[model samples]
Target: MMSGFCRTPFKYQIMKKITLILVTLFVFGCKPTEKAVETKLNYQSQVAVKGDWQVTDVSYANSDYIKVSLFDLGNTKCFVNSTWHFISNNNKGSMKINDYSCAYESDITWYINQNNEMVIKFLNGTKSKKVTTGYVVQYVPINENKFQLIEQADVLNKTQDIVLTFERI
Candidate 1:
């Protein structure tokens, strides 16, 4: 005895509710499962690092680029490099990064050692002898296209606290 217009909207509402509920359950109830295979490099023993990644951020000297390359160093460590180059229009100057190796000059290193603990070291070129330790916080994958590396920077007088977020390229 109901009009077609009334029934159509009522059915649409019901369908929407069910769809919303299903989406919520799927998103909240199911968490990403870590791959069963153990990785040789256990940077964070508790969490598995993503096997595939893309560059999310790059800043070198006066130039910045989003293209980066992540390379596996031995023992769950990694080396990231920038692959972007361009000419600056303002000064009519050329600027770009041709390398991405992180050494004492680059204040960044992350690794999961045999001890089953994650360690991050932020270095300054001047203080090559001393490395202040920071909490080896687990990074969260923001989405399919982004990786978030969050940690407190070094405790040195010149260090700046930072929360670095990178997008997978």
Candidate 2:
């Protein structure tokens, strides 16, 4: 009878340990997992501007200012009639300048951000990520076949809009 009594307490102790472990596992297993939320890129404007486009015109709200260089490539006149090709699927494109003695071409990566800004990076044989400098312009769509890239420029200490009109080809 004494030996049985000792064994019963030992069994109870083992049972208590097993129950504690099971309860711990149950509590931890039922916990909700945390997941990282990723921001989805807006593709509406991307789809609307996808295709071949030509710079039909470049105009400034205040035209009394001096010659302005655009994107450090050349004068604003150089970009007029330039060709731009946008590939929405890969967010890559190219700009070709065949006017105003500014004969130049470059591979570019572009994307429309959540703020409706067109961000462009000119890659001159360098990786897209390696190029730190970029240009941001407000993207304004006039219609399916036409759009405007408005860049704010400081002219005589005043902010002015330099609009570049594009037409689909």
Candidate 3:
């Protein structure tokens, strides 16, 4: 099988190789360059925090991570009777703590602070005053309906780990 004059030998082979390389480059360049982390950042920034949330568990993320259930804290009645309603499209919310009979219902104005934490501006029965320093919150959402909120005593200080989980009601 020796052809003295093969039309598609050196020139055709080089052309085929260049075509393959160009196709590969084009395909790769056209693909999306966005990453999951960057996408998450963009998604989280615009996440909605307006809804009814309940404190499901409050644990300690220290050397010994302990999960404290609402009942275990001996505040089942208070926690169960409580209602947290966050005003939509705004940073205002209310926390009502009361008994089953609604004997002591207290609503408070809450706002999303600069650290993405819930700042209780004023309580219903307490000294009506906007708190300058507020608590820190780390909202870790699993999906649209389900999420976990990690609350902290201090936001500026990272020495403490997240120790709270709130669920949507």
Which candidate number has the best lDDT?
A: 2
Task: Tell me the number of clashing residue pairs for each predicted model.
Answer: 3, 0, 0
Candidate 1: minimum summed lDDT over ten consecutive residues — where? 86-95
- CA lDDT, every model vs. true structure: 0.39, 0.88, 0.50
Q: Where is model 3 more than 4 Å wrong at Cα?
A: 1-47, 61-82, 98-105, 113-115, 125-133, 153-162
State candidate 2's TM-score.
0.73
* RMSD of model 2 against the true structure: 11.9
Full candidate order by TM-score, most accurate first = 2, 3, 1
Query: Can you write out model 3's per-residue Cα lDDT over 1-169, one digit (the tens) per residue?
Result: 4564575587788999999999999999899884221211222422455678765544544424332333122333345435566664544567655455433344455544334444444354554454443343555656666555554433234444444455678
lDDT for each residue of candidate 1 in 1-169, tens digit (9 for 90 to 100) = 5688789999999999999999999998897885332223443322343233333442322223222222221111122332211121211111122234443123444445453333444443424237654345445556555655543333233333233445433
Which ten contiguous residues of candidate 2 have the minimum total lDDT?
A: 33-42
| TM-score of candidate 3 against the unseen true structure | 0.44
TM-scores of the candidates in the order shown? 0.28, 0.73, 0.44
lDDT of 1 at 119: 44
For model 3, which pairs clash? none
